[model samples]
Target: MNPTEWRTYLVTQESRSAGRETAAVVEAALSGGVDAVQLREKGRPARERYELGRRLRDLTADAGVPLIVNDRIDLAAAVDADGVHLGQSDLPAEIARGRLGDEAIVGVSASTVPEARAAAEAGADYLGVGAVYRTGTKDVPDETNGVGPERVAAIADAVDLPVVGIGGIDAGNAGAVTAAGAAGVAVVSAVTAAADPRAAAAELREVVGDGR
Candidate 1:
């Protein structure tokens, strides 16, 4: 997948991942038009995470959607995942690029223009920006305080890479982020916790596509 296609992203399978297994939710999301999937299993043992990544790798490969492993470059490399998403505190993008090589996608989380620019300069293929709204899916630093659409616009303006607005995003407000110049939105609970994961993903895809 190319940078432009990161739109309609899904960051997967949290504890709130209700009703179905993580793989099932991801399968349904891919079928529903999620362009990419990030396997973000924090707090699990490396072995457990690796096994899960392997399962997701097969599923995502079959669907032809990019699967990004969160944080663990080793796990990503082990599974030959399409990419890895790094946080501010994680490994530097340049180093990740070195380890993952040129073909693998490297995305970094950024909350400011400077951070976004640095990530881009460091060889990041895309940027995940926000806490666009207050969200409990992941613990965000209090300083971020939900940067909102304007910050997303600013970061989009500052960075040459694709910017995906994450945190508390759903079909209702996804358009605002897209209109603010984000190439896409990264969602967690909005899809994972939904009664119908496929339907939820489809709705979000519609909303984001309309925004673009």
Candidate 2:
């Protein structure tokens, strides 16, 4: 899928929620209008992560949505995923692009304008920019405070690629991110941890529409 197509993104399956299976949650989210799904299970064994990536690739493919593997280029290639999302410590976007080739999508995470600009120059197809609100969804570093919606706007302005706001995003604040110039919002707990993942995704999609 093209970067512009990522209007409602879901970063997934962190084993923290009771009775919330990753495959089930992804299926539900897709049904409710999640445009893209990022398989982000960092703590799992490689075999487990690969198996889940394969399952999600099939699920997302069936839904005609892009499935992006987080921080694992090899896993993504193995599963034939649509793309891979890279963090600052991961392989550079240009190198990933070289390995994945022109047809594959590559996204990089950035919290500041310079990072966003550098990612753009490195040939990233899109940018994941935030910590837009205080989030415990991922293990963030001490120096990285939530940059908020204003930072999303700043990063968007600094780069030509599509930008998706991530971290602590939900239906309530998703619209604000979109209004601040993010092409989309990426969420983890908001959808993955919800009692009704499908309903939660739908609600967030609705809120994003209001902002657009």
Candidate 3:
């Protein structure tokens, strides 16, 4: 499915999974209704991440969900993942699309209108825009987190590509992001750390659906 049609996107982080493996959490999330999945095991050895990506690639394939490798085009190709998500610090989107080929989905992370427009012009298939609320998913600085729905609104208006609001989003607040015009919302702890990842994803799915 095109990410433009997704209502919920899941970014994996095993460290916050409360002991479950990343693939396990992702499987549960898929059962619950995630439209897309991203393998984002930062700091792990390349071999380890490749192994995990292989697992995720299989799971997402069987579920007919797109699997995106975070910040690693080579790994995405290695795992035969559906796509790659690039941070501003990562390779340029044109380079990603060029290397991954025309059929590959290329996404870029953006926090502002200028960044969003740049990404769209750079050949991004979609944009992951935020740290929408204060988050602990990573060491996000105070200024980036809590940028709010207004940021979503601004970026959404500035770009034509689908926008997925990320960071600190959960069922309770995901609606705000979508309401502000995001095509979807991406979450880490909201599902990965939940006691029941499937139910968390299901609830979030419902919220995002309602949000639209």
The sequence of per-residue lDDT tens digits that candidate 2 reaches over residues 1-212 is: 77776678999856754477799999999999999999898789999999988899889989999989899889989999988999999999988888888888899999989899899889999999888888887788655558889999988887888999998889988989999999889998888889898999999988887887
C-alpha lDDT (0 to 100) for residue 182 of candidate 2: 91
For model 3, residues 1-212, the per-residue Cα lDDT tens digits are: 79889999999999999999998999999999999999999999999999999999999999999999999999999999999999989999999999999999999999888889999999999999889998888877687788899999999988889999998899999999999999999999999999999999999999999988
Task: Estimate the lDDT of model 2.
Answer: 0.88
Position 204, candidate 3: lDDT: 97
In terms of TM-score, which candidate is strongest?
3
Cα RMSD of all models vs. native, in order, equals: 0.9, 1.0, 0.7
Q: Write down the worst ten-residue block by lDDT for model 2.
A: 12-21
TM-score each candidate: 0.98, 0.97, 0.98
Kindly list the per-residue Cα lDDT of model 1 for residues 28-122, writing each as its tens digit. Answer: 88889899999997887889888888999998899888989999899999998998999999999988899999999999999999999999999
TM-score of 1: 0.98
Per-candidate clashes come to 0, 0, 0
Candidate 1 vs 2: which has more TM-score: 1
Model 3 residue 179 CA deviation in Å: 0.5
What is the C-alpha local distance difference test score of each model? 0.90, 0.88, 0.94
Model 1: how far residue 6 lies from native, Å = 2.4
After aligning candidate 2 to the native by TM-score, how far in Å is the CA of 121 from where it should be?
0.4
